[model samples]
Target: MEYRISEPFTKEKFAQLKAGDTVLLTGTVYTARDAAHKRMVEMLQEGGQLPFEIKNSVIYYVGPTPEKPGNPIGSAGPTTSYRMDAYAPVLLDLGETGMIGKGQRSQTVKEAVLRNGAVYFAAIGGAGALMAQRVESAEVIAFEDLGAEAVRKLSVKDFPVTVILDSKGGDLYSEGRAAYLESRE
Candidate 1:
């Protein structure tokens, strides 16, 4: 089924998600990559304030290319999710409720999602141009020196994503594979 989720996801909103569901996200989402995640975790370790509030927020693991003229953003597609696994549990513990990226997540991240009632959504990789079209506007919010790796606040409309992992521990990857194999038997 299709779901349209708003930003700053609430418990009620997250509870409705299940693995394998399609979602159209409309609202604000923050961008971050490896360097940004490291900095944020370092700040946390030193008892510092995060650049933005993590509570009920969604973070997209992407580092878009330089925008061409007349575009709000460049090729904005999802990065590999495993790159952020080392830092995900901390963010989840800090109240981050959703993640948008491509590829799989670590078991630790999966556990964190279940414990914190968070969800993981996958955007199609290699669809950068198509994804960028959904981004109405974007501005760097922090770590400007990191260039494309900087954190940016993005306003998106009808951004496509698939629920790979739900708050209840449902995982579409394993389930889908199992079903496919079963069908051939």
Candidate 2:
């Protein structure tokens, strides 16, 4: 399903996405990894305002390498999501609706997703070259001193991803693996 972040993604729209659905993400997606997540959470704890609104936004957990000439970003791909687990619940509570990363999230995050009507999407872990093509523009949004770990606002086109975890507690990785193994047996 194709969507632009400028509008609210309805629950029905989110429900239409399942494992293996192709997505064209044509809107602003915030890039953040472990360091950025930590800072954001710290700010929240201190009662500080966030640089950008998290409500109905998609947070892409990535630390893209520097772009070469005529490129938007370099080697863009998702990092492990487990590192962001500690801070994710806070953002979720603050109305962040979607997350893009690889690997599994903690049980707490899964519960938060269910309770918050959020979804966890996964980009191919090692497909950096393929992922870079989807990025149309990139600029640092906050925490610029963090270098590659800085928060970035990425404008992407036809950014492909899979729904690894859904708001209802459905897990594609484990379920798909189980089905594959069962078929071979």
lDDT of 2 by residue, 1-185 (tens): 44433335445557666654556666778999999999999998899988888887889999999999998899999999999999999998888888999998899999998888788999999998899899989999899999999999998877888888887777888888998999999
Worst 10 residues of 1 by lDDT: 5-14
- Pairs in steric clash, model 2: none
Q: Model 2, residue 55: displacement in angstroms?
A: 0.6
User: Against the true structure, candidate 2 has what lDDT?
Assistant: 0.85
lDDT per residue for candidate 1 within 1-185, as digits (tens), equals 89988766776698899999999998889999999999999999999999998898899999999988889999999999999999999999999989999888889999999999899999999999999999999999999999999999999999999999998999998988998999999
Q: Tell me the alpha-carbon RMSD of every candidate.
A: 0.9, 2.1
lDDT of each: 0.93, 0.85
Write down the TM-score of every candidate: 0.97, 0.92
lDDT over C-alpha atoms for residue 166 of model 1: 94
Instruction: Point out the worst 10-residue segment of candidate 2 by lDDT.
Output: 1-10
